[model samples]
Target: MAAKTDDSGPVLPPAIEYAWGLRDRPPKGPRPGMSVPAIVDAAVGVADADGLAAVSMSRVAKELGAATMALYRYVGSKDELLALMVDAGYGPSPGPPPPGTDWRAGLTRWAWAEHDVLRQRFWLLHVPITGPPITPQQLGWMEDGLRCLDGTALTEGEKMSTLLLLTGYVRNEATLASQIAEGSRATGAKPSEMMPAYGRLLAQLIDPARFPALQRVLAAGVLSQDDDPDDEFTFGLDRILDGVDALIGRRAAT
Candidate 1:
């Protein structure tokens, strides 16, 4: 697709416009079936199978059985390709919560929907956030999340901020889980073995007198084994919603 030239409004990346259907495919060069979504899907396939490093103009072109230069006719550059890939990778929003669901439950469902996507497509987490949500699917997610707060007393800005906070927590939790799993694989240790080993190592390295709080934790065997993976994620999600609930309460009160 060629870049949109009618720049009367806010300037946006071509891929963003392409995803939104604001840009049209050039009349001639690209192969008959080749289009923006087609190209983005092929690129996502490459990333999913071989990891993000395996994705490049040449590689994606090879997958599509086309010349590398030909890809430029559709995607202007690799950065543009990556952005489109992320939008496609996210697939779609889970849609708004069912009617009558409270805001906290809606946001919880929203947060988990995002969490599930990142966990499955961990590569999406590695993609740098060039800016805020602009692509269609990304904005769909933002819209659904904002819809959760539609009847709330909080201001529009507060609703957006609350979603931001929730998304950040979900991403951080997923990243930490992925990293820990990777670390366990690299060392060939079972996930269940990791915390116990860590606890033992810490016990030998610290002095009870100097690290009394930690010593008590060690004595209590808090790190004897890994907790259910969901336990940590659920705990953090509830705490964040608790704070949001309190704020919503304040807004309703005054």
Candidate 2:
């Protein structure tokens, strides 16, 4: 697809235009076996099998059994392909809860849905986000997430901001969760074993006199034990939801 530009500036990159179906195939009839979706699939496969580092244009082309130049006919560049791959990897968001679902439950489901997507496609965490959602699938996820706050007292802008806050929290949590998974695989140790090792390493290296607050935490004996693996994520998400609930309460009061 051709890139869209205006007196203001470029609205959609060529790849995004192709993704959103704003434009058709690039000129000269893109190669017979070459399509944007095919190229992105090849790239995502490479990323999933190895990592982001394995997802160069040439690598994806090799994975597709096409010449590297052939991919350029559709994708434009590696960065463009990365953007397309990210949106494709996310696919579509699930439908929101049935009518009459409370805003808090709906929002919690939205956050967890985002979490699950990222968790499954851990490589997506490594994809750099350049801007807000504009790709069709990305916008679909955004639309579904916004529905969680529908019929609320919050203004449209506030609803959008709240989604940003919650989605950001989900992504941040996903990154850490992915790292922990990777560490466990590398070390052959479970999450429970890893935390205490980390705590012990900290206890030995951290000077209590120099770091009183950390010392206090260590003294509490919390890190030395194997807590629930999901305790941290659960606690953080609950706190964030509580804060959002309080905001809604205040808005309703006013």
lDDT of 2 by residue, 134-182 (tens): 7778888888888989988888998999989988888998898889888
- Poorest 10 consecutive residues of model 1 by lDDT? 1-10
TM-score of candidate 1 on Cα atoms, chains taken together: 0.92
Residue pairs in clash, model 1: none
The lDDT, on a scale of 0 to 1, for candidate 1 is 0.86
Angstrom error of the Cα, residue 149, model 2: value is 0.6
lDDT of 1 by residue, 170-205 (tens): 999989977887898899998888889999999999
* TM-score of each candidate structure, all chains considered together: 0.92, 0.87
Where does candidate 2 clash, by residue pair? none
What is the lDDT of every predicted structure here? 0.86, 0.81
Shift of residue 98 alpha carbon in model 1, Å: 0.2
Number of clashing pairs per prediction, in order: 0, 0
Query: Which sections of candidate 2 miss by over 4 Å?
Result: 1-4, 8-11, 24-30, 184-189, 202-216
Best by lDDT: 1
